[model samples]
Target: MIVDSHCHLNYGSMTEDMDGVMQRAREAGVGTMLAINARLSEYDEVLAIANAHDNVWCTVGSHPHEAEKEPGITAEQLIELAKPEKVVGIGESGLDYFYEHAPRDLQKANFLAHIAASRETGLPLVVHARDADEDTAVIMKEEMDRGAYPAVIHCFTASRALAEACLDMGCYISISGIVTFKSATDLQETVKIIPRDRLLIETDAPYLAPVPKRGKPNEPSYVKYTAEFLSHLLDWDYDDLARTTTDNFFTLFSKTRRP
Candidate 1:
């Protein structure tokens, strides 16, 4: 079975017909999915989905885009909310220079707060770094110095140097549908070098849909295509790729209890 380690099932695109989307995921062999929270205000809805599904889990943190709005969100607040039975990760938070929707400094401060929560709670920080590779890497390294915390760069599309830096810090790398794109040759090259144990696959659904399913609203089922492409790219059997990534998800998000 495959696990979609990151997705936004609570988003409008998926929530409109979630039952159908989830049925399709099961049909496509996606046995588990983590419903990511990008806003603290929506944690209740995100957790509601997880509470109803045996295979679905959730996280509690704000995205970089919502950094300004959640400025008062402290490590203590995250730590408190994260005690929920369904919350397994600290964030989908980090720098996003591509959009810069929020001030860069605010984004960085919120990112650091999420990292602090991860350190306090022992949950993997679900990072979302965009074009600000240098600053992201530097901050991650600096934070590691304070106290090492488990983390993963979700939907990684940063430079090879940044990937190497994250790997050096023992951070996990999650591949999304972006890798299946023809123009992502650099990412493909980077994917080849990632250690199997430190690798993960996600759809980042309702956003980056893979080829053949491109331009359509993405869902957890599409993660299989990303996994299939990566399996071929890495020259490993599909089952092996699926098994290893699913195992890696469980290892990093150990707070999740499978039913």
Candidate 2:
């Protein structure tokens, strides 16, 4: 079975037909999903979804876009919020220079807070980095100097340099449907170099749906297309790719049990 390591179940059309979304996912062989949290204010909603679905788990923290609004969010606060059994990770956080929705300083501060919470709790940090790889790498390296923590770079589309940095830091890299695009040659090349054991896959649903489903709203079921694309890209069997990525998911998010 495949695992959608990152998604927002509380967002978009999926929320309108929760049962259909999950049923389709099951039909497509998706057995597990992580409902990511983007803001502390929405943590309860995110947790509720995870709580309601035995196969679904969640994280606790703010996204870089919501950094300014949750300016005072602390490592302690994230740690406290993560007490729920269903809250299996800490973040969807990091730098997002591409959008710059929040000030860089504020984003960095919030990102560090998340790192600290991850460090303290041993929950994996669901890092969201875009066009800010250098700072993301530096900050993570600096934080690692203090203490080690598990992490995964979700929806990764960064440069080879950043990929190497994250892999060197012992963090997992999650590939999204972006790699299936013909225009994603660079990303595809990068994927070829990622060690199988360190690789993970996500749909980032209600967002980057893979080709064929490109124009339609994305959902967990569509993650199969990504697995199929990667299987051909990596010259591995589809079943192997699915099992490998699913195993990697549970390894990083150790707090979660396979459904």
Candidate 3:
């Protein structure tokens, strides 16, 4: 079975028909999903979705775009909020230089808060980095120096050097449907080098649909296409790719093993 390691099912696009969305994911052989929270204000809604689905889990962290608003958020606050049984991870956080919607400084501060929460909770940090490889790497490395924490570079689209650095830091790399894009040659090359044990796959749904499904709203069910593509790219069978990534997901997000 496949697991969509990152997605936003509580977001408007998917929430409008959440039951159908989840049904479709199960039909597509997706056994589990992580409903990522990008804003603290929507924490209840995100948690509600997870509560209703045995196979769905949630996170507690603000996205980089919401950094300014969540500037004072503390690691203790996240830890308190994350005490719920269904919340399994710490973030969809990190820098997004491609869309500097929040001040760089605020983003950095929020990122560190999430990192600290992850270190405290022993939950994997779901990072969303884009066009800010240098600073992202620097901050992650600096934080690692302070003490290491589990993390995964979600929907990665950074320099190969950054990918290598993340791997060196014992972080996992999650590839999204972006890998199936015709223009993703460089990303494909990067995907090729990722060790099977350290690789993950996501849909980042409501966005970045894979080829054949591109130019349309994405959903967790469509992760199969991305996985299939990665299988072909890696010259492994689809089932093998699915099993490896699924295992990688469980290995990293160990809390999901709870009943």
Best by TM-score: 2
- Tens digit of per-residue lDDT, candidate 1, span 1-259: 9999999998857888989998999999999999999999999999999999989999999999998888867899899999988999999899998987999989988998999999999999999998999999999999999999999999989889999999999999999999999999999999987899999999998999998798898999999999989988989999999999999999999998654
What are the models' TM-scores? 0.98, 0.99, 0.98
Candidate 2 lDDT, tens digit per residue, 1-259? 9999999999999999999999999999999999999988999999999999999999998999998888977899999999999999999999999988999999999999999999999999999999998999999999998999999999999999999999999999999999999899999999987999999999999899999799789999999999999999999999999999999999999999987
lDDT, model 2, position 5: 92
RMSD of 1: 0.8
| Pairs of residues at least 3 apart in sequence or in different chains that clash in candidate 1 | none
Q: How far is candidate 3 from the true structure (C-alpha RMSD, Å)?
A: 1.1
Model 1, which residues run further than 4 Å from truth? none
How many pairs collide in each candidate, listed in order? 0, 0, 0
Ranking of all candidate structures by their lDDT, best first:
2, 1, 3
Sorted by TM-score, highest first, which candidate order results? 2, 1, 3
Stretches of candidate 3 exceeding 4 Å from the true structure: none
Candidate 3 lDDT tens digits, 150-208? 99999998989999999999999999999999999999999888999999999998889
Candidate 3 whole-model C-alpha lDDT, 0 to 1: 0.92
